[model samples]
Target: MLFRVALATGLALFITQIKLDFFESYLYDMRVRLTPVPTTSGNIQIIEVTPETVEYFKGIPKAEHHKKLMEWLIPLAPRAIVYDINFDEILGSEKNKKEFARVMESFHQLFVLTNFLEMRGEEGKLKLSEPYEKIKLFSGPKSSDTANFAKDGVTRRMMINYQDQVMLHPFLASQINTEIVDKFKIKGLFDFLETDQVYIRFRPTGTYAKIPFHEAYKGLISTQAFKDKIVLIGHNLELSEKDYLMTPYSRSSIAMTTTEMHANMFDTLILNNAISKAPQFVNTLITILISIVTVYIVFALSPAMGLFIIILLFISYLLISYFLFWPFGIWISMAHPLLAIFLCYYFFIPYRLIIENRRSWEYYQKNKLLRQVEELKTNFISMMSHDLKTPIARIKGMTDVIINDGFTVSPIQREALDTIRSSSDDLLKFINSILNYAKIESQGVELHLQSKDPNNLLTDVIRKHEFLAKVKKISIETEFEPLFPIKIDPELMKQVFSNLIENAIKYSPEETIIKVISKEIDGMVVVRISDSGLGIPAQELPNLFMKFYRSANAKSSPIKGSGLGLYLAKYFTELHGGRIFVESVYGQGTDFVVELPQN
Candidate 1:
């Protein structure tokens, strides 16, 4: 059990640690979109560069655009102006550079974007895309990049510093109030603060005020309108070849630009709604719990009940993870934890089967004594049958010879010989039944199948019982539709027919009718022998074919019967790949049906 528990838990953690929670992270994005915090518009705003504005400055220098924007906004004394666009290359003439640098130095709160180049390994000096000399000198290498795309290429998280490169939103936030970003400095999945990350709680689109640069440059808002609010400037969707990332608010072909992403990150940090992955220990505990619980359920319950509860367990865990994690700004492992539960249930099936099979073996061992007693009974029946058949056969033979030799005898003596012959025949039938039963017990029934006409078999059985029917003053009626040949054991099928017809004659009253019918029904050969005489009670019908079982009516009647005939008939009929059934109403009538597959 411990080994299985360890295996399940280890597999779960392996999937989780490999960051294979793609589906889980997708749900996290869904959660962010569903339950967004209130818009934080009062503290932040955006200035966008649209296609028209980019066209407006097509032939002009990039420095001229930055210079005009700085000259316009410096008078308002905004909290900070962080650029989300890359200004990595020097452009324009030297006069243009010096002019932009002078305007940029006037606003001490201005911060420009820095781009980081990724290397093969983690340890190194931060490789930066060198911005235009003037912007770097004024903004002091501002890394205003808050994008952290997960495995599915969606920006759902933000890191304070990634691979020795500081991010933008928190950088500006720390400058505004060091304590604002300090509260979110919690340890991440591996207790590594060097690359700590948290989920960004985004707001709906239009949550921030954005103005095209043409409008902002041409008096979009009053000069006093920008006081104390942090401003972000970057590309708008109207621009071709623009930088964009997928956010919770993004859909296909509609993504947020770098400016909007920064706005959301800034708000998430200040509002303190940053979600973190649940602690590793909590995740570990949950994985172990699901594994052990599913294993226990499989071991303790029946397979069907175990399957039902396992399904319920899966749904319940999902609900719990959604509610607990979404509201609390933490995400528990969903994909792999569910995988753990399923693995435990699925892999433990064979183990449970082996245990059940062992238990069945133990039960069979305990019943050894009962099986031995049954063997002894079959042996005794066989011995008695061998000893009794000789005398009965001799008596039947002697009586037949004397009766057929034409010896003259008195009427009383002749009648006595006839009685002896009849008694011997009954004894011979009883002995044969016992011997057949013993043979069946020692070795199972094996059929010597042959294709025979069912109609012929039925007529032969009726003729053999004609004398008894005549003696009881019962009329035998036949209605045989032409039947197809069926594969069956001839002798065994004949025995079945004789047992039913003889029972019909023995139980019937004088002047009753016995109907024997054979026909093809539903592509199979069917035979029914019905008697209008002492019918079986409904309560005893279920056990009528049991070995040596007699009904109450039979016990009270004067009929000489051993009660094994119908049992043998049923056994033989089924061995021929056919079925026998009895239908009777108490004190009314009885009917026997035999159906065999026909070729």
Candidate 2:
């Protein structure tokens, strides 16, 4: 147990560490894969960059498009307007870049684009040019990248950190924040500084509300203004190639574009408690708990059952992580924890099987010996019974003759003779049962293969047992369905039915009903003989057909029976390629069913 526990703990820890560093990234990817975007606070708003606007000034003059965006911003007097476009370098006429920059300045609500880089520097570096000094930048901790390196030196879980400083307000953030501050006529960032940042929570992936950019631009939205809110600049169009990411969540496309990558980073900021670090001890404890649980389950269950449990547990873990982790800022490493659980299970199984092997072997050997002893006793009983049959029959015949021929005996002497004759007949029948049981073991009797009508056979058996029923003051009832004749050995079949009916009559109470029914059930001929008798116990049912095995009820009864009737009946029933079974309840009655296949 200790060994299994230790192994489980180790596997869980290894998995947990991997999750903290990398698997969490996959979770983030999954979140993004659920289509993400930002909505303005409280109201519906539009930022239109339409084809018509592009055509309005003859092929979307760059200066004119910027001016139109300015126009839209001023009229709406919106909370904030974010320009997704960036102007890092002058691509068109340098004058046009300057003009666009001046228009952004005029709006005062608009924030323009600037880039920042974080990189390692040479120890004794030459002075950089002025062109490199204009970009906005902020510094924080040197990015710590963690990944796995294989023997071939290939890295998995890529984390790139090429800058010593990051852009605090990337182009979109600058634009949106600028618009909000200008429209409200109040400084931004200061109020947000003293207050806890409100995280923008969203429903999970596959559940986000998608509003088309065209519809928003066309004034079809519920609300038409954002008086005091931050607006996000992103795409909803399919043709736009600006969105893509390579994370596990980005399964739909080949890859995510650079703009989408930035969008995800911004989402991380909005949902500020994005990354979490669970204490090492907590992770370790959880690992241990899961391992121990899995090991215990595996040891307790059968292999098939254990596998089923493991599958359920694995699914449960995924579900818990799916629902719980993101909400609590808890990032559980799904793969590693499960791996640990299974590893523990695997280790425990072999150990458990090995430990139980000796106990199992002892049990098997004891049962085998008990079975052999039972067989020997059955054989002995059968042999002795056969040996006694001839003498008992002879004695019965001679006594009958002496009584019938009027040997000049007194009345009392005649009565005694009659009693002796009856006892001899009973003894003879008992011996015949033993002989039949022994005969079942011998492969001597050739089954007379013939197609026998089951309905006729059922009727005959019921008729023959009617006398025994009469003696008990029991009524025998029958119901037979016309069925196709089934191939069987008639003589063996008769012996089978005789024993069953006799046992029923011998065991049943007086003045009760014995029902015999025959029907075609599932392409087989089924004969059910039921009697209202002192029934067998539930626990003894499995051993009912064992040779010389009688139920507890039978053993305690006054009825003169050899306990070989059902045993012999079972053998003969099987000999004709049929099955026999009994259903009984204590203090109720017993029903014996003989099912013979159609073929």
Candidate 3:
């Protein structure tokens, strides 16, 4: 999980570092469009230099017309006048230069635009283009120019400082009042961008109060409109694309005029509004956190729920970004965090599915092989038990016949015949145990259930084990507590009791006591068979009832028997909804307990 988050975060940060222009521009423009335009303060106004005004002054030089307009505005006493036009060339006669300089100097507050074009010299070093000598001399310290736009030719940000010198908008703002100038000195005027530039918090396009230059020149616009207003004079005519620039508000078919762009900058300064990009580390942290959460949610829920959560998260992130951009003027990179979430979920879910499917297939194949092996084992045990049962029974019968025949025989022959019969009986008992175990395991055993007295059932099992107990000289004792009748498979119950008693007689020393007890307790019947015997070891007791399991002590002892007795006993008892348990201590004694539901 950590690896997935790290990979996703790395990929997101890499993409953000690349700063793809189109993607970034799209997001930035969308944010601009969605933001509500703020109410205008109407303190700044534009006087457009339209084509009609240029045509009106065609016979005369453009500089002379600018001089005449300045003459008309000198009496209005405007707060300040900013020229967005570039007067960077030697124009007109010497008389025109002196008259323009004189009129420009007369204004108490004035700023002029100076174009500084960066060009490579012969040595490939950048050089700044110089402004016209007359314009530079007249504008003095108030000279400033527009900043460079992005590579996409869209003006999303404004330059605050270039080459350690203040740019136009901030320089103009500093000249407004001592307080604003102090703010400029302390906070500096622009919010930082990826390239250390600042974004322009643009109002809606053409939002400022605008008037045609022809109208203002003809005295159609009243002087009061210019009073106390910072007036901007620039060309808005559709002469060429030279004065037109793309902005966040620019559409495929429309672009804003450079005059309007400068006016927007001026308005931003007045309102003290700036948009700043969030720190890179902040964006990276958000990306990583969202990526980890996406991975966890996808794994923890169903695919549909995960997708829903992703959509919800996307919307929530958009809201957060919008709030930051709108009210707080903070711009954070949204693409990376959203993309991190998408890629983490998309890649991880399928990878996990493929892994789980492969494991399931392996388990299926293993189970198939195990089933085949179990069937073969059941068939082999069934056939071997059947084939051995008949021969062992016949051996016992022939030995019995010989011993009973009327004939004279030596004492050694008589003892040999008796030994043969006993050996045959033990072999037959072992074969029967194997057959019964296999039948039960193969689901071939059918129960003949009836309501039978627990005492009678246990007594029958004891009677069957009497001969073996007598041979070992072990005394069998019984304690009964009037057990209620229980519904059970009689033969299966008898087999359970027979195995317990036989094991007690086999493991006990001669003359030891084997006690059988039955009682009703807690709505259940419990039977306990205990013996003074060489008890099972503590470590081997857990596996004692497992199929074909024998303790080390039992394997080395002289007593001979198959190990299926206790395993089959446990199986048959459970089949009748009963439980079996054992308590033992090494070298002391052992007790086997069976509990059956009374019903």
Model 1's lDDT to the true fold? 0.75
Best-to-worst ranking by TM-score: 1, 3, 2
Give the per-residue lDDT of model 1 (tens digit) for 244-329: 66666665334667677778777776666666677767877888788888888998889999999999999899788778665676
Superposition-based RMSD of candidate 3 using all C-alpha atoms, in angstroms: 9.9
Lowest summed lDDT window (length 10), candidate 1: 137-146
- Of 2 and 3, the candidate ranking higher by TM-score: 3
* Candidate with best TM-score: 1
TM agreement with the true structure for every prediction: 0.60, 0.54, 0.57
For every candidate in turn, the CA RMSD to the true structure comes to 8.5, 10.0, 9.9
Ranking by lDDT: 1, 3, 2
lDDT of 2 by residue, 268-337 (tens): 4432323343445765676778887898788778889988998898888777766555445455555456
Which ranges in model 3 have alpha carbons more than 4 Å from their true place? 2-16, 54-61, 88-97, 117-150, 175-196, 251-254, 370-599
Residue 453 error, candidate 1, Å: 8.2
The CA lDDT of each predicted structure is 0.75, 0.58, 0.75
